[model samples]
Target: MPTLPHRLLHRLRLPALLLTAALSLPTAAAPATPAQRLADIATRAYDDQARFDPLSATGVGDHRFDDQLPLSHAPAERARRFAAWRGYLKELAGVPVAALSPADRLTRELLVRSLQDRLALAPFPEHLLPLEHMSAVPVQLAVWASGQGEQPLRTVAQHEAFLKRLAGLPAWCAQAQANLREGMRRGVVQSEPVVRALLPLLADLAQPDLARNPLAAAARALDTPPAGLPVADAARLAAAYRTEVAERSVPALQALHALLQGEYLAAAARRPGVGWGSLPQGAAWYRQLVRDQTTTALTPAQVHQLGLREVARIQAEITRVAPQLGFTGDPLRDGGLLAWTRTDPRFRPFKTEAEVLDAYRAIDARVTPQLPRLFGKRPTRPLDIRAEPEFTRATASDHYGLSEDDGRPAGVFWAVIPDPTAYSVVGMGALFLHEGQPGHHFHTALQLEMPLPEFRRRTWINAYGEGWALYAETLGHELGLYTDPVVYVGQLRAEISRAGRLVVDTGLHAQGWSRERAMAYWRDVTGAGAAQAANQIDRYLAWPGQALGYKVGALKIQELRRRAEQQLGAKFNLAAFHDQVLGEGSLPLAVLERRIDAWIATQRR
Candidate 1:
């Protein structure tokens, strides 16, 4: 449930433009071997990608572009980025893959597939339709500007660089307005609900009170000098910040607020329907979205059917545990025990936000001691739990935020409980397992600390990333953390929720299902509250094909684990298998299969 950075999208689509300087490196006299060629390409690609994506660069501890936010919404910029992708594809196509080692070959295959995914999206007008409820630019920049995100604000120079970058907000917002208008002209705007969700967030940003405004508060914090810094210098920087925010940031955000509330929302409201099928060439675009997100060719009908089967399977398991939790009834009648478990007051355990966080901390404590039994390795970065920022907590759910490679900040597990008393404890264990331990923190922290290719550490493929977390959800049983019957049911409920994703995601995007229908189906299958169901459906609308990754990736991992255990028999080590998966970092599900297969072969020998 970690929010994907907006710059990651930039990295995928605009990795080429940043490479203009990188591609100018001198050619070797003789053709290099495949290993050397791949190594060189990865190094160059990471450098160039960071150049195009300064925000991402800052996330990974690169400070070179700390003072810049490029005008990415301009048409000219998109054209340049598209051209760069083609040029890099051509360069990659020339590499002789037949001569490379297996590991190098895997990296080549992944790099090429990633480039193709980026190119596949270029023929469409998605660049114009950039803002979404899940990762809107206005919300993300506020987070960064508040010094709560990847942007560094430790040193005086860092703060000055941020101020310079902050000064560019007017131009950036102007470009966004222009692009949104273009998208409206092209009939490619986001859904109405997604656009409407932006209204309140932007309103909060445009608030006049500096104390209430997240961005202004970040600037105001500069009033206090850090460590040995002079008070006069800090005071001077603070004044400059307020001046820039008044003259630049506030007006830009106000303009953005007007555009969203007036033009964009009206246009999107007039659209025929929320699904991609309503737009021009939307059917083909949705198909491509499925392919890119899942990295598979399975049709919508196929994924939907698979979801039906998985949902039923997980429900049966939940029913089996129902009796143990003191819910006795006809085993399979009208959602049976699952529905009872959801509505029963016994399941609603938390009375306050502190209580919810304490439960999460307890879950983490219970899992930590058992972690070594399940894996050969663990992340060096310590994990901390915190409540989500109140401003965005309504839209945000429980998620894990990663730390920088330098380890200046430890990774955090964020729980957003809007109404603490109403918080359901049914899936708390599975959620913590997925978002906290051996899930995101486990996957991301190890990648940062590992001595792998920079690309591998930073790659943000959703299917592989989210899928691994979902897979980790199932590990609660193996790790001895799902001891209580209620906790085990929570795990089952979590799995069913993921299974619903495969169905509802494909149903909404590819099958022409309405938003209302998707919500209905989600409620029936998962027993989620109205707000929870509505929020998830809007997220799927905002990000087509993304929800499919969780189930697809988890199923693939589970399938591979079964295959490994069956093949190696007694020799199969769960810890080694897990290490093989996590140690390589995030991969496309296809690449993951190949890696696991290779490991299974080695174990057989």
Candidate 2:
């Protein structure tokens, strides 16, 4: 929906190692109060964490590490990072929970739970499995070099730092290859499908054509002097890029291409080796993924069953919606109203990019006024819509991409209009609700503005984050965007897709459902076409338990809201309820539940 869990900075993987670091504390001679102790510890830990992960630090608005990307998978760096990891937990454990205010306690719990989860995953050597088809080193390189990502390219130093960053990549690949070799020896490798899926992307990056290479383009662009820069500095900068990125970096990418195609792919497992259950120590690993992703104790089996119930509930709503539009065919069928609406001329209204952008803006206009009644805080920037180049529009779905927080942009509501005539208007409003204003844009923007510690402000617990966005879709009714039968049905369909994920994700990983079976089930429940269903199933294969977070998180938030309304009766302020949920940035669902429970108790008192 709103581009995967990068809001949580999934790429910034924290390695769990065994070592120690001193937690910085208040320098005042007097003993710090519990609240002061927590603030100090969290602040110090957040600063250290930023320095530890340069890429993550860049994403989170810290520019100190803009030039350097550490060798995270290398043996020694992992050890030092873990030492800092332990210090975060150790410092927090020193704070007495009884003495701290609820707010500080909440931050403490978020940081501790985060560190503990990282600690728990220590047994799993994910570093060895670092190469992802979706957002691996190759993908990140393209993005940063294009000046669209967190890595700053404006300053002469930033440009130089980037060249240094590029120089580091070949070594990173070597380290990754070494780790993959170790994984191969240990019976831990990417599933064959994942390896194959990654090949094309890597091969493209390894292409020798400098014109087509974004990495090289970034370097060449430095040849032009900036407004105040000396001509001499520009020449040096351009030469650095030529030597480091062009001459050296380009060759390294080619080597990585050969290594993966020749060796790593050969080592990956065959068909149906998609899930973690197929890997070494797989069952436990899958379980840990479930725990870390959803922040719950629910097993895959339990999650699957919960998904079954949820799928049925959402499906029934979609079915009820069809009759209002004079469509009676079974929506559960692959060739029913769900597919018909997509191709139906009446629903495929937009004929140009301008039309599509206008529709999104209109949806925003209608929803914006209503949001003030629901919550107090909102993003400063109004949701902005931008259409991709005609050829770049690969899907009909629209999504929100969070800005790198460099003041250049905020959350963007991207309308992917591939052939506008082929794009359906049926679910457009629901898409807006999920990806626009009150959905991702509001939640993420508000989070950035939170006065909480850096870690808490930036935290993105999947269940809490994705759940809130999905739950926000239901606000369509309240916001008056879903009163139209088509829009309401669209909302149901969007939600049902997530519900289907709950079933299909667990089914594939835990129940041993084949790719064919998983795709079929996904289509049956969500009415996705064969190709769409297959693509989605493979995404689940790439990320097990991740799809579960959407529905699981939404259900939990819905439950908490119901509990609050029932308990508070007329005292329940929708704004207050919303404030409670969004006030502390995203939280683990369980921790969110506790906050809501405490809020209810306080209101009663």
TM-score of decoy 2: 0.90
Q: How well is each residue in 1-605 modelled by candidate 2, as lDDT tens digits? A: 01232422355333421122333444566245888777777777776666555665555455666666657777676766666668778767788999988777777877788787777777777877877665576566666676645565766777777777787788877777788788888877877766777777677667777666666657566567656657788788777766666676678778877888887777775423677787788888889888877889999999988888987787677677788898977866773667767667998887787898898888888878788899977778556776642322332235566544244746777676767787778888888887777887877788777676877776667788778889999998888877798888778778888888878878878777777888877777766677677657766777677777888888899999999999999899988898889887878888789889999999987
lDDT for each residue of candidate 1 in 53-81, tens digit (9 for 90 to 100)? 56666665567787877666577766766
Deviation in angstroms for 71 in model 2? 1.2
| Least well predicted 10-residue stretch by lDDT in candidate 1 | 13-22
Model 2 segments beyond 4 Å from truth? 1-9, 12-31, 219-243, 269-272, 351-354, 387-399, 404-409, 415-421
| C-alpha lDDT of all candidate models, in order | 0.75, 0.72
What C-alpha lDDT, on a 0 to 100 scale, does residue 261 get in candidate 2? 89
Question: TM-score of every model?
Answer: 0.92, 0.90
Model 2 residue pairs with clashes: none
